[model samples]
Target chain A: MKTAALILSAVLAVAACVFLLAPLVVVVLASFSPTPVFDLPTTGASLRWYGRIANLEGFWPALGLSIEVAAVSTALALVVGTLAAIAAVRGALPYADAFAALLVSPLMMPGLVLGIALLQYFRAVGFDAPLAGLLVAHLIVTLPYVARTMIAGLSRFDFTLIDAALTLGCTWRQAIFKVMVPALAPSFLIAGLFAFLASFDNYPVSIFLTDVRTKTLPIKMLQYIEEAPDPTIAAVSSLILLGTIVLLIIADRAVGLSRMAGTSD
Target chain B: MPVTSLSRRTLLKASAALAGTVAMPSIVRAAPKEIVIGGPAGAAKYFNESVFPLLKQKLGVTVLYEGTNSLTNLQKMQADKAAPKFSVVIMDDPVMIRAAAEGLIVPMQASAIPNLGKLVPGAVHLDGMWANYQLPWAGIAYNTKSGAPTSWADMWAPSHKGKVIVPSIQNTEGFWNLLIAAHLETGKPLAEAQYDIDAGFRKLKSLVPSLLNVYTNAPQAMNLLEQGEADMIGGQFSAYTLTRKMDGAPVDLAIPKEGGFAMPSGIAKITGGPASDLADAVIDAFLGPDVQQVLATKAVVTPTNLTTPRPAGYPDPATLFAPDWGFVAKERGKWAERWTTELL
Candidate 1:
């Protein structure tokens, strides 16, 4: 009975992998395909799409925009979310549930809705087309993901250690800086990673908040797909997939894979 | 009496002083330094890849071309209304008309585009929008080898239920599907179809139960048919033909008896963008022969401009489903709402 179950489990895992990998596999095939549209690659594989992606001028601009947005948004989310998480977990403040919920309002709201809401707010305030607008929009969307993960890490923290430090005549700031900061290390990085991933993949907010000048990679990708369907898209998608996989591997080494995968924020 | 008079005068003077302290925005003489233009991903990428090089060389202004679905693009417009980020957007005629009504898109100064007259007659001001680029028909495709289904009526067959796929009539597909339902439900020919929101709603409600699945975009429809999970589906010609010929998918289109919808995507030029000149130039370049050919060859679509010859590797437009643009523009929103109430 045990042997049969193991074999069944193995087959199911392979099937699951194939199901998830199907679209990417089709795209990889199409990227190397000679015919333009939908032919799956059978015999000769060429670097046709890779060449197209390299040659397209939008490649660099969009890539730069994505990296910049992800980096900035992650930094902002980490700061704001970390601060918020600390306050919540410490329970030193009043009405913590309400505060936490208010901070995470963006998560409850759909990205499409949030993008529109922010646009209206921006317009009403007469501030449009600034990097600050995009940064704030991305930060709001990414903050919740960071907060959720950081909250987990904060829970594992030893309150007794914090109390012991305080009783020993250590100031509140010192106890926080040394004991609490070190305790939240693993979770902090995970929060940063969530922040980066959320901002990197965010399309709804980016679409609404961005003007033509401030457009991101996903926005540009959508443009290309609508007007022209080509193998070049596969190349771009493949790059995104590769970037994500690399991050996942690095994250696993930095923090345990189980924790990273266990509670996806 | 003297004290009261003095206090009233002082209050008036203080109010005036506070008003004078408010800051005002600066005025610009030359058009701002850049223009924000937006379109579907394909159009935007074309601007970024094919046209921007020449535009930068001549116009000397940076043009931002945002690309996405028509509905999402509209959402962006509504979202970025404060400080009005994009000065120009390319969208279908009906959407542009509705957007104009909703006060989302701004009207252009006719003289800004010297070639406005180059637009086809009846298209000069279709719903107050000048034609930037004319798109062709959107309709049905089904597999012939799988029992030879022909025409649109066969799509409603019970056996094909759960095997047939059409795009969701919410958000993106909502507008077009509503128009189709209006025509089918009202029994009105293309000529008689007008903006009847009530009729459109009733039609869409009836059509909802007939569908097996309501897809979101071109990809899912094509995927289902390719895998033989679905035998029939609605799609743009771009992926449908590509999948049939190249993917060797057992799927082909059944031309509908009711003329399919032919719509045009146009860029509305607004005053705020500094790169308006560049934006206009880019629009001209998109309609140019070389780029039009590329679009035709790559997406299995034809150039809307008559001067440009059809590129190789696709069926002639005359042979494909005929679309009535006039009818589509008139009844777009009514049908869209009807679709929302019925299908979604």
Candidate 2:
């Protein structure tokens, strides 16, 4: 019975993977297909659409925009989020639970609502239609990831060393930077990765804030797809989706996915 | 440089790009031949039927349909000058005129497609674009349970306060509705539609608190109506046909007394793309008789060519109200800004 159940589970797992991955596979195929629409068997195979992607003017700028936003957001999230986590774990604040909850609030809000709300709020506060607005909006949504990761890293950290540092008369700031930071380096890195992916893939906030010059890849893709639904979208989306997965794989390979997984929780 | 020089760690990334290139359709271009058409996929089907066939028989070229939304297609045409990708763009009139002003489209000789004479008056020669298609109907759509709303004013009846839905005034249709609603509230014709704008804005603002959702797309709201989620909302002339087609739902299009809103879409010639001639061929097909018959059956979308007959179970286009296209074009941006401020 157990063996039968195990076989069933394996089949189910494969089926689920196929269900999730087939559309992506078909899209990858469709992106390269000669025919404009997805239909019956084609003559053989093709690559003109991918070439079209390479040649499209929006391709490079959008990709660069996505990468830059993700990188900046991740780096800042790592630093600020790690510090917050270390401080809370060190028992620096009263009502730390409330503070932690507040830090993670952006994660609970839907991206679309958060984007529009930020747009309206920022406009009312006089920061509308600018790159600074996009950055600030992105920062708010990504801060929670850093803080959440930092919290886990802090919990797993060896506090005795910090206690010794306190006994040794080192400043709290000095101990945090020199001692606490190294112990929680893995968590900080994991948080940074999460923040980068979130910012990189973010469309709602990016689209709202994006003007002519500040447009990101996803926004360009949205604009193009809305104007023209063709095989080019499959090619572009596949490129982005694969880029993200590859980035995740690199992160997992370089630093243990488990440490990040633990920190993620 | 050899692709092998790519970082060993980034091989996966390198392979993906290479694989993408390897899989593209192998259609050879001997002398740079293709017809690049930019329009909604539904709009592009005429390319398959009318234009592509004619292009092959006459010009000896294949066409690529770049099915997309109205706004960005125009932007793409503007950007692609040196080596154009699209030969023709079938899009909304506002974008087409905007492109013409921007000098994105090449001016056409009246000698070509003499069928321009069949188009409605406002659809005639603009700076560089011409109206080849139009949707001369727009007004509030109500839940069948709310009874027929014969005019725009009935949508504001106290009963619909909690259930009322309106399209997002951010889109072109939304601003168009804003202009029409303003005119309807004051009981004016299209020429006098502008005189009573402020009263309409103020009246529209009052319903802000009661709105359930600001819908963006037309078809999506029609779905909500069939589900019985909306008591009243804005819609196209053909909302009734789609609902009736799907399980005999009693949803219907309401032609308001002040005359249903008039909005027309136009086709602009893009300088880029080898397939432009094909795009023209498609436009010719759109004006042809075959597709118009199919279009009529689906919805009450008015075909541009006056020669075509109305579909069975659809209203005659003659009965619907039409506003000044030139005036609407001029006022679109300002009205859009107002809508953003007032409705969004």
- Top TM-score model: 1
Predictions' DockQ, in order: 0.15, 0.03
Cα lDDT tens digits, model 2, B74-123, are 66676556667677777766666677777777665445655556665555
User: Which one wins on DockQ?
Assistant: 1
Q: Which consecutive 10 residues in model 2 chain B have the weakest lDDT in total?
A: B21-30
Candidate 1, B1-344: lDDT as tens digits: 53365446545654443343222111121245566676665445445654555556656666666666676777767755655657677776656665666677655544655445444444445443545454544566665455545555556567676676667543333345555555666777644543544565675565555666776555545645655666776544442344344434555654466645444556675435445566566556555555565555544455655666765544455544333544555555564564456567
Locate the minimum summed-lDDT window of 10 residues in model 2 chain A: A33-42
RMSD of 1: 10.7
Candidate 1 lDDT by residue in tens digits, A1-265: 9999999999999999999999888887777876454457666787877887767656676677777778767776776687688788876779887877887778889889999889889989988545568877888988998888777777678788978998998776677668877887778788888788888888998887765455578877765565445567887888788888898888899887888777544
Q: Could you give me the TM-score of model 2 versus the true structure?
A: 0.53
Error of 1 at A27 (Å): 8.1
Worst lDDT 10-window in candidate 1 chain B: B21-30
